[model samples]
Target: MSLIASSLTFMKTPLTAKLNTQLKLFKIKVKQNTMHTLNSILRMRRDIMKLLIIHPHLSIIGGSERLTQILVYELEKKRKNIEILVLTGSRNKELFPETSKIKFKLFKEAPVKAKNLRIKKLINAFLTLSEVMDDFCPDAVLTMIQEPIYLVLSKIVKPSIGTAI
Candidate 1:
């Protein structure tokens, strides 16, 4: 019985050593993966530029709408690394028929008690836009009209540039 117990204890020493070696190898592999991901993100940050275009409404197709589409098309053609995002509430497919690659983010219409009040609706839209801006983290924001709310929020966001046309 004493000999059997001594043999079992001796066998456990090699098993414990093997387990420790495997654990060290696993930690090394995890560190390698983490470093690889960090390097990839750094490269992407250097290569790509993010841009967001905001429009109050796009329910109708007109000169401004056509111009916006053309501008995005030309910019992408010139700079392949530029990521273009269009933010609007309207979903008129005809206005952007060829913009399959461009990202289209439909603004969420906020509900308010005074539905008839235009100011309240605009305020709600501004709040929604603020949330979207935080998520997108665009390098620049472009909008046509100079809305007072946008002006104030733009200062707070401090994007590279907030151009109002």
Candidate 2:
């Protein structure tokens, strides 16, 4: 199990302490259960398990993007039945030449005025992602960032996973 730490403002409040404790406990639980989870997956009768990894952008080389790419490579190397599909909004495909081992889908670009409309662009991104999620029907969805699409995913029947980093 991998843990990504984010800077949290330290405080004396009980909420802060509780949050820290909960994180520690969650980490321990994951460490203990990881082996069992992998064994369960190995025993599953299904021929293939589709994993959709959502990374909003891949135009730049960032830590999260690198991590996602490494994860896809490692998972595919371990399990032949696991299919990794990287869903991104990045138009610059040349930057991710290392991801030839995994499948990728460039989501439809959301049309908006070429003016300063950040909110509208975000909304379009959410809609495009929603459509992709529906079409893919993946067994699991890993969202790298918390976007409005995450909220929409929570209401769907499929399982969605999110990370703090």
Best by TM-score: 1
TM-score of 1: 0.66
Off by over 4 Å in 2: 1-46, 91-95, 98-101, 112-116, 146-165
Query: How high is the CA lDDT of each candidate model?
Result: 0.71, 0.66
Per-residue lDDT value at 10 in model 2: 58
What is the lDDT, from 0 to 100, of the residue 161 in candidate 1? 51
In model 2, where is the ten-residue run with the lowest total lDDT? 1-10
Tens-digit lDDT track for model 2 on 1-165? 223234332555687678778988998999879977887877763667777777878877778777876787788789877767777778346645534346787756577655667666566656665776677656666776656464454334334533222
Error of 1 at 11 (Å): 15
lDDT of 1 by residue, 67-150 (tens): 787787788889877877887777577766435347777766666666567777666766766776788667777774455555
Colliding pairs, model 2: none
